[model samples]
Target: MTMSRRAFVKTSAAASLSVIAASAKAAAYPTRPITLIVPYGAGGPTDTIGRIIAEGLREALNGTIVVENVAGASGTIGVTKFYRSPNDGYTLCLGNWPTFVLNGAIFKAPYDVTKDFEPIGRVVTDPQIIISRPDLPANNLKELIAWFKSNGDKATQATGGTGSTSHVAGILFQHKTDTQFAFVPYRQGVGAAMVDLIAGRVDTMFSVAANAIPHLKSGAVKAYAVTAKERLGIMPDIPTVDEAGLPGFYTANWHALFAPKGTPKPILEALNAALVTALANPDIRKRMEDVGQTLPPKEQQTPQALTQLLKDDIATWWPVVKEAGIKNE
Candidate 1:
């Protein structure tokens, strides 16, 4: 028997509704524990932040949350694990700048960032500081630029890795000022970089204010300028790169939240809500500030905003990557 056009259409609509109902039912979500994939070694900044966020999420969602560190290949190995996980609310990933953006662009990856994961919201945005050994003759950004131009690539700068955010910040500094320096890639953490900076082994370095602040206070290192649109409230005396002669020089290290692609809409919304609530807690805000980070506004902290930011970063860094002659390490 042949079905009439109206009957056929009605049947198709019913089938679609049934599928939606089934999906919504399946999306009741998190009957079990959730795993937060932290793509870094234990005790690292990413892992620390991931655990904090996981705790907050667990309290809010009323389910156990675990932060799993799957470190290797500069975080790609862990990130790959997250991207390939089941696209349920049970699996999320902790991601930060350069690792989430520049790393994927510069290194071979098993999963495509845009296609394999769903962005939830940004966790924090930390400003990077251009610091020098306390004994350096250059006192600030202008003096440092002049010194580099005069010295001509004789100065050295240290970073955790070649394509890290710290390294990119240094690259942007040279690109803006039209100078060059010997880029020293350190296998160790910022602690080693701090040691070298103190001993004057490196002439300059780009690192987060959190890592540099203690030393800045101890007289071991001097901060030249911060790569932020404005001076940090904690260090208002310090000028931004914009105020220091490069009018538009700005960069920041940022962390973001993500779920494997195909996670339910309700789950994503719930995660975003929990993130916003967490950011409002006075304790969380203070802790983030202590680490040189600030919470972005709620309106600009969503998945859509992250997508645009990622796209803009791709545009912003592609030229810098090419101009700096950077390659995978």
Candidate 2:
């Protein structure tokens, strides 16, 4: 049926107005404060990194950014919240391996990492450090291995949670070293696990360098080895796990930014540009470097790079997790 001339004109005007409004919205971009969701509790390494990035974004975008911690379920709960939010670019999530890769590999998460989120950019990557109570009779990785071998299941290893980065590192370490520990899990975050390590309640843990550095310096925890190919400049005296007799042992924890799937491309580009600017600031670079956080090379700091990294990590870890029978508790 042919439409009336008046109705046709009115419909055309409405469609044109909608297009203009959307374009205006994209140009205005973040007219209001953005909420950045940190998928871990406050005071943990992830939270610290998230807050730092949030501050940088606030400066770069010239807008307010509020970081909200929605910690639980190895970070999946917070990430799920992010996935379900409107894709208007107002909500974002600061996610890492636990939330983005491990949870999907080990458990039936509510969202898919590759399908449910739009990659923003990677902020930092931190190597894992094997640390133990200061009194643990182990000064280096070799001695630590020996101690574990002798103590067998008597030695305790602390993990942030069952499917957490710490847990994955612990599993890989045990598998490599042919040793076992009585695992103790803290579902909240690494804050409590660090506390227990400091107080000698737990014997050891594989921790992100950022979270373990201060304690390592304060003489509260003994650093056994870093889970990187080389010693970090910030802690050059610490030997790498490979140098300390665990050949081919390397693992790292990384943080990346993401918006819900279907966010406008212009908004995503703006966010990525802001992130690149934040990462280039001298103060930000220095602060991250001081904590042993390594920024990705310039080319690898883009959304495409982050997307590829997520896919690669899922491919690399899924089989290992499945073979080891790691399951979310």
Candidate 3:
């Protein structure tokens, strides 16, 4: 069909206006206060990281970045809320390993971890550091496995309730070693569990690096291995899982930024740029590092890196969670 000259001009003008409007929208992104939703309660690692990112974003974006803690249901409640929120860049979901990946397996989450959101950038990562009571009769990973195999039923692995990184990783540990240790859930928090471990009441723990760092430094708990490819900087003496007789058993509780799936690419780029800026700040880096957290390498700080991290975790964890019948508390 041949278009009339007048009709052609009108169509071209409309298309140009649409393009200009979209660009303006992207450029004026975060025109209002941007809400960064932390899917956990205050004072937790995830919440702390969320606030750090929010502070950095508040400065980097040069706009108001308000942090809202939507804590509950192992972080599923807040994430579900975010999954249903507007796709506009103003509402960002700050998620980590459990809220974004593990919870989806334990609970019937409404959103898909690998599909329901657009990535901004991965902020920080804390390796899973396996620990035991100082006198557990297992000084290293190899002996620990041997001990667990013989004393599986009597052994207890303390965790911060079910479906947490510690609990899920504990399940993975059991499966990997063919051990049958029982899980001890702490309603108060893992800090309580750590105390028990320090007192030699609990047998072992699959702890985050931050929680285990001070204890490791003080010789309060026996350090087995860090479940990551590389050794942790703060506790450089701890060996990686690959080097600790349990090869290829890597896991981390990581933080990253996300918006609802349909956000524009320009907006995602803007968000990622701000995140990169925050990660590069010496003070911000020190704060995270002080907590035993490591910033993602500059090369892996992009939205694509974040997307890969999500898909990779989902692939690595969902099956283990299902096979182990890990359930939410």
Candidate 4:
């Protein structure tokens, strides 16, 4: 069928207009401030990393990125908020292992870990350090274990609530050493827990190296060992769990960025590119490294890498957490 000249012109103009609208939408993304949700309280390791990344993102995008701390339920509460947010790429969450991978195994969280978010990229990974109050009288892991055995449940372990990394670390410590400690739950996050530990209200904790470093250096807490296969460069004086006589014990915490699922691909790519640029900055790298964060190699800083890590961690840790019968309180 042959179209009339007026009808053909109208159809061509409509098609051209559609293409321009799509291009305009892409070019005008992030027209307003973006919110990056942090699933823990302020001053915690996740919060620290989130702030750093948010600053870098602000610089990269030449736009505002604000970090909002929504702490509770071992980070599930905040993550649930992120899940429910609009998938317009204006909202994101800086999530780590416990919130993104382990919470679903231990609690009936409202969102599914694998299905609820779009991975942006991973930021950093840090090992946990076994730290205790200065007056604990256990200078090393062996002494600490023996002390726990002698004291029974008299010694208290501070945790950032149920299903948190600290909580799981405490459980694993008990299982490995065949000992127990009275657990004290702190809903706010490690900052609150660390405060109590420093004040001698709690006897011990397994904390992220970056979180524990200041206390360790200030003589408020004593570091026994790191929860990695090898010693961290930032704290070479500290021994590994294996070296500290816990032969097979290892744990590491990592942080990554994610947006609500169904965010447009162009926005995801833009966010990721900004993240990669920020991570590669020398000042950023040095600051993160000084705080015991081991940035992933350039090859492993992509969205695919973060997605695979979430999958692998879920497969590896869910069974163990289930068998241990851990649950939210």
lDDT of 1 by residue, 1-329 (tens): 99999999999999989779756754565679888888766754566567777777777677789888887656677788887899878888888887778776677788876567888999888788889888989977888889998887488888767677778778777777899888887654455667888898988888776677667777888888888888988778889888887777777878899988887777788888888777777777777776677789888778899988888887777677876777786
Give model 1 RMSD, 1 decimal: 3.6
Most lDDT-accurate candidate: 4
TM-score against native, each model: 0.83, 0.94, 0.83, 0.93
Give the per-residue lDDT of model 4 (tens digit) for 63-174: 8999999998899899989999999889999999999888989889778998878999999999999999889988889999999999985889999889889899899889
Alpha-carbon deviation at 91 in model 4, angstroms: 0.7
Error of 4 at 232 (Å): 1.6
TM-score of 1: 0.83
Q: Higher lDDT: candidate 1 or 4?
A: 4
- Model 3: how far residue 57 lies from native, Å: 1.6
For residue 131, give model 3's deviation from the true position in Å. Answer: 2.5
Model 1: lowest-lDDT 10 consecutive positions: 185-194
Runs of candidate 2 with Cα error greater than 4 angstroms are: 1-19
Ranking by lDDT: 4, 2, 3, 1
**Predicted structure 2, TM vs. truth:** 0.94
lDDT of each: 0.79, 0.89, 0.84, 0.90
